[model samples]
Target: MTETVTLTVRGMSCGHCVRAVTEAIRAEDPAAEVAVDLAAGTVRAATALPRARVAALVAEEGYAVQD
Candidate 1:
């Protein structure tokens, strides 16, 4: 089953950052539905990927994912 998660991200300063995060999540889960709110520095995704994997992906992109 797909699960939805909202992660509070740090260091997302611009549109590029938002795109990077969105791409990172999609790369981890091709079927994931991702939405990033740049102003809020948050990402909401509906994915089958595990939470730890998601967090790692964000971290790899130099962003911190806050629970």
Candidate 2:
């Protein structure tokens, strides 16, 4: 089953940041659904991958994921 996780991310200021985060998640799971709320600094993704892995991928994109 797929799981939906919402992550609090910091330092996302524009469309580029949104795309970067979305790409980072999609890179891990091509079929994953990614939603970015730049104003709220949150990223919601529906994926089968574990949260830890998702967090890592987002971090790899140079953004800080709130714990």
Candidate 3:
């Protein structure tokens, strides 16, 4: 079953930051659907990807995932 996760992200100062986060998540799970809200600095994804894995992907892109 697909799971949904909402992650609060830090260091997203612009649209580029949103795009980067979106890309990073998609890179890890090609079939995952990702929606990044730049204003809210949150990313919501529908997939089976684990939270820890997602956090790692964001960290790899030099961003922090707020718990």
- Rank the candidate models, highest lDDT first: 2, 1, 3
lDDT per prediction?
0.86, 0.92, 0.83
TM-score, model 2 to reference: 0.95
Which pairs clash inside model 1?
none
What is the lDDT, from 0 to 100, of the residue 13 in candidate 1? 91
Worst 10 residues of 3 by lDDT: 12-21
Segments of candidate 2 deviating more than 4 angstroms: none
All-Cα superposition RMSD per candidate = 1.1, 0.7, 1.2
- lDDT of each residue in 23-53, candidate 2, tens digit only: 9888879999999999999999999989999
Task: Give stretches of model 3 more than 4 Å off.
Answer: none
Index of the highest-TM-score prediction: 2
Off by over 4 Å in 1: none
